[model samples]
Target: MSPSMPDTPTPPLALSPPDLRPWRDGGSGVDHVHVRDSGRPGPTVMLQALTHGNELCGAIALDWLLRQQVRPLRGRLVLAFANMAAFERFDPNSPYASRCVDEDLNRVWDDAVLHGPRDSVELRRARALRPFIDAADVLLDLHSMQEAGAPPLAICGMTDKSLPLARALGQPATMLVDTGHAAGLRLIDRGGFADSASPRQALLIECGAHWEAISAELAIDVSLRFLRHLGVVDADWAESHLRCPLPERQRLLRVGEGIAARSQAFRFVMPTHHLMVIPRAGTLLAEDDGHRFFTPHDDCVLVMPSRRAGEAGQTMVRLGRYED
Candidate 1:
């Protein structure tokens, strides 16, 4: 498990991890991948879950959809459960241990990594799922945060098409326009999804806290909305399943920079909340090694501040500003 604050005890596992054994031998020839085709000609929409095994909301959401036998009304719909090997090892007593077996599955999406000789559990899986991801016209990768009570965020990667799609979803309320992490490429930013000229777009939603019951609810609601938005699922059926009310409007936050930890001693001056806006410029935020981080501009927003004691080069927090 990653090193979290010593003062804070581990939160209770509020949501049970779903039994995913039935989905092992999925329809797509790839394990845990199910594809439904309308055979009518439309965009292929893919909903992916369990990129991180600890983030159970997405897995619960995908399992619920599969159980409901949700099919596309127009084109193909792909429901994939990624990092199942890691997920299979999940124990409620120590939920954080199974995020990945070797490395984060979400980080090995770069072409060089996938095509390289270096082999790992996550890389193999990413390679296996690459074809389906390539074929998708729209992709929604569901995830959850480490910190509790943080608001849901749509991670719209650096692409013109992504922000517009997030605006269309309208629920999550807050959208973040960010480049993929420095460590590696995220699944959402891979291939055509990140290409401005390509019609394909992908979004990664941070639903809420990993084990929160409400996170699962939000995940399902977002999935329904995403499917409905893509015209893959019937509007009435999707609407019936949506439990959350639409936000009054969506706000966009453009990430200016991600503060990566330079040492194991990295820490914030105080507890920081997600989407917390600091009114003044040059306010103290965090310190790593000998370097200190401060607000670069007035009305600076803190996005996804890490509660854990970060490893060297891990993103401790991202600094952003509201666009609207």
Candidate 2:
């Protein structure tokens, strides 16, 4: 049996989708992608937004930068609005329906999928954006969550290099270390970005709840910090726009497993919050049909518990543990 949809009404939309018509004919051959080059030699830092159309904070951040005329001081600054086809369909009345037009754009980054004959609205755009993504020496993919009021998270892809960069950024307060989903590879884990020996690094920030007013604020702050950290933008300008104070330290959570729902009956014992830590090893977290989920170890962290009803094979939540 299919799961029943949640009875709760969607939250009020607090963010206005920025007007992107001005960026349609960007300098980059690909539509909706803008590139700025500095004559001096430096790394190409790419700031990508709109990976998921429903996530508006990223687009807001990039739009703010463009309006401010922020450009690289030494390197190339690539500001890309990815998955614009999906973004174009964004409707405030049914926001989540437009996360992607077909398959998730973030999951199609693997070469096999990119090279294969399989087609999607998302796949085609990913292909067009691939060359620029490949050229980037540093990348920051802006994203947000479905759960309201959740704290911001830095999804540091599975590499030794990313954790340190997240540590250096120093906000967001929590960082998650995990491999890409079984569904497919994420853009952050694609190519040299995932290779420990490669200098290419990427960080995907889940700024806050999708459609929340604060999410846009956090996105812009993080974008400035990222540019400032890499010396891509002038220090004075970056500092001028940065509104958030740095967190004293950021905590790391290494995800051990992603729990996929096996049946429509899957449900948590109680409400779950993002980054909520279960204190006991055997405490019940959720149930699916007849099976129950328990914390694997003491103080297991629940990462991004699904706000919607779970469908079979959908990842409901990820379980992780804090690193000392």
Candidate 3:
């Protein structure tokens, strides 16, 4: 049942947060433009959501924030929901349905691609909002994994600038992956995902899997914690948002084959949902017809399945309780 299921006491939708509606800005396909003291002139914090069009978990929290009274104690708070095309195309009980219309929105942070005349609808949206991201003091881009077992984690992407902030989010186990923060290959990695974004920085928090009720709530919780981090909100809420993080050091298991292999052989493996653990020297996924075998050489948390259906290599993230 959905969290909004009729039976769950629907926590009296409070009018405490801000409200966004028409959800369309003059048919430009810009879903609701909500501003809470935008010009109050303090450090600007941008929380961009639903960039993928399919991930609507943030939408609920966005709605809650809209309905609630957000009194940012410090800098200004700006909330934006992308992909109006997908939002309009939504079907009930299937929020995280469309990843993108043509290409992934989160993968286009590069201004050149964003501004290029050849950009697709997704890229166009990315371009339209460049100024906001460029000027913000901080950016908390919320996202959820597709698999089931992968614990909620924050991606630092090896950016020296974003490392400390990642650590601060309190996920405990932080992985320092190598990727550029500017190319926009992924929504969060570019410029080494380590840029010293002076007066600004970004953190990508994987709340939960697709359509998971807690995903939206955790998105909201993290946003509140971010405000606290910026000194824009009270410390109490931040404290509440903090989760007992995992460990300092972690191991990133490699997905040698990628998604193509999984599609043909793996069965019943959900990558975006974050599930399955491939024990070292253990059978990760047995190929149908018994022609091939998938196994892990080291003990690790199998992250995202590289293969579409293959239950082998992919999002395999093994965390350590101790720092190596």
Candidate 4:
């Protein structure tokens, strides 16, 4: 197996964070929600960004959409910048510091959590945006990876609802079917979005590592393709801004489970990259204070292995495989 690159003292700041002050007021009743409806009437397509404040690729992509004045010809297009409070704290020197001011916005989508007494910057924003999210016929949440050199992939969740949409997109060769985090519910996992029979579908794409220029470009390319797929934007418009190669074929991986770091001392047997395939069953992968981890099955694949051992209960990496 190839060795992981040495940790950079500071990851290069490849792109500037977009200034989103103009979009804060929003067209919808809520803040950061802009909706444009075509009189012809079609699906209400939503493109969301800034779910995690540290993930700037999404913000840059949304900013481009607003700057280009991209509008729907048939369906309604909703451009939302979620968690502005956290995004306000983004600093190039500490790129990962502002993931969220209080709690992870992506994990607070559960109906109970939205309606409960627990309150924070993320929860409030998610609560205010639930109605808009529920109204979306198709949704795309943009994000970026934590580890450098990881390939971009479309996260289609554990269900088949998003599988067709994943295939329709022109970029990203790998599609991951995830069961989601045990810590909380994600927006993609909420209501009809995850139901196989429901017309409402959503996908989250990790567009390479945060703070990299390539991630922003990947976000824009994928977003354009997604808009084209829903007929929210014309092929001509999409083709004009296309900057990446279309995948010849796509592979599907079904995530089995996430391996949590028991403590800050957790360590992998060797540094692993995202999508690394393990050939044998019971292969040693990692170890914590007194705990050990091994592959549950043969041909096991590692998805998004973290460089940081991380605190207790944080996901170190996820184990997955090709869907047979």
Candidate 5:
């Protein structure tokens, strides 16, 4: 069992869980796969939500898109609500418990992991969804953070192709380049999306805190921009629904390494949030069991500090640096 850490109050659930019943029997021959084809030649763009069941912002955005009758003007548009089994278990009082049913859906995208004989609720879903994902020319996977007050982020793989796609979305202020977790590959990093030479591109957006009302709005804004950028929807239609101005500029952060919990006693020296930069090298970040972890370099940025203290071998936070 995980040791108990400090008791922090759970944030009020500002957004209601989306009723995904209407999308369950999607026309794409797969559950939750809503595909719209313009019959014109263009790239097939996919927008996926609910990668993590606890993250409701993306689900809300996808719900709104359906209500608004949003469609494609070019090739094809796929709006997918993933991890339904996990999502169905979401409870306002215990929101975090529903992040997954058996395993994280986002982490089972590797070819080896997907093709392996291993069976789980999430892996089964991933296998079923892999065909649609493999057919997509571009994918935008929506997500949200664990910590409150953390700004929105565009998580891209370490490739030039995806960086520009994140920049093109232009709502989120920070674009983080990463190789993904050591435990497994993410949906965005699967197949051609991981290849720098491949024209296929994917970007994962961390809209904001999991249940915040504003996170839903941010998801809608970015989703609209993604559609507009791909010509799936016209600029007028997308811009009309935008509730806020776009960021003047976006900053890029290159993740250097993740600080994994070395033991069950891991604890941060201080409270941390995403994009918090430590000013000097060797600054104490955390202590785990008998070991101490310090910043390796000056101006080290911490990404997504874990709320679950003492979760052995799990990533506590990622350390990164700004890119010029």
Candidate 6:
């Protein structure tokens, strides 16, 4: 835990609603903004939706949070509908309409690309949202996975500033891995570096079931809880939203493979619902062609599998702490 919070509130903060925008996500046609209760001055928290495009729960959850008049235990808030284009393009009746139109928007968070020529819609939007990201002190890039029983998890890197949140949201699990900042894949994780210099806490909640309501509710509850715990909202309101107490200790799983990949034989993996103990050395993979498979250590509960199984990809993960 970093030495930033006190056992009690010294100076209360205020928060407004999250601001939304469509100008940044390119021209796929989905654009949105949500601003709430901004009269109070507090820390700036930005909640965004549709990072994966198909993850619908977060979008609804954002709508719920935006519609409320939240009393900040103390800061400002900014909410955005990240992918209005993809949201509009996909029909609820069609499950596989299109997770993305041109490219994966979640993977395209870079400032320099704003002026560069873009070959795809993903690049255009990434360039547009640079400023909102730059202004935020904390970002909860909400997402959902195609896994069963995800149990709601929060992932933060080695940033000490935001680690408190990981500890507080200790539900499914937490991991502190090197996100390959040079690759420009994880913008919020890498972009937040300027605020704390050393690692600052960032949240990537994998709620569960791409379109399930449970995932969305958990994401929203935990987010509001975060605001409360950190003085962003009234502690009472946040406390009312608590589903799970903070876990004393959480585990971090290393990516045995890249997060975005296909398992030729597996569609997805539910790590939290397993009973077998995982071994430390190899990976637990959906191998179809006789490659090898392994998991973490002797007693670890794994969650969130990249299910797009097929071919050997970098998305398979191994669990570990930053120092380990």
Backbone clash count, each prediction separately: 0, 0, 53, 0, 0, 50
How do all models score by TM-score? 0.96, 0.96, 0.70, 0.95, 0.96, 0.71
For all predictions, the C-alpha RMSD in Å is: 1.8, 2.3, 7.1, 3.1, 2.2, 10.3
lDDT of 1 by residue, 163-282 (tens): 888888887999988866777899999988888889899999999888998899999999998999989999999988889888888998888668887888999998799899999999
**Model 5, 6-61: lDDT tens per residue?**
35466898998989998787698989989898999999999999988888999999
Each candidate's lDDT (Cα)?
0.87, 0.87, 0.54, 0.86, 0.86, 0.54
Among all candidates shown, the one with the greatest TM-score: 2
Q: Which portions of model 2 miss their true places by more than 4 Å?
A: 1-8
Candidate 4: tens digits of C-alpha lDDT, residues 239-313: 899888987888998997789888988899886989999999999999899899999999999998877653588
How does model 5 score by TM-score? 0.96
lDDT of 1: 0.87
Error of 2 at 320 (Å): 0.7
Candidate 2's residue-wise lDDT over 42-140, tens digit each? 999999999998799999999999999887899899999998888899887777777888888889999999999999898999999999999999999
Candidate 6 lDDT over 136-204, as tens digits, reads 677777876554454555556434455566666555555444343333456555566434664344677
Residue pairs clashing, model 4: none
Worst 10-residue lDDT window, candidate 3: 1-10
- lDDT score, candidate 5, position 280: 97
**What TM-score should be assigned to candidate 1?**
0.96
Report residue 68 deviation for candidate 5 (angstroms): 1.0
* Local lDDT at 185 for model 4: 87
TM-score of 3: 0.70
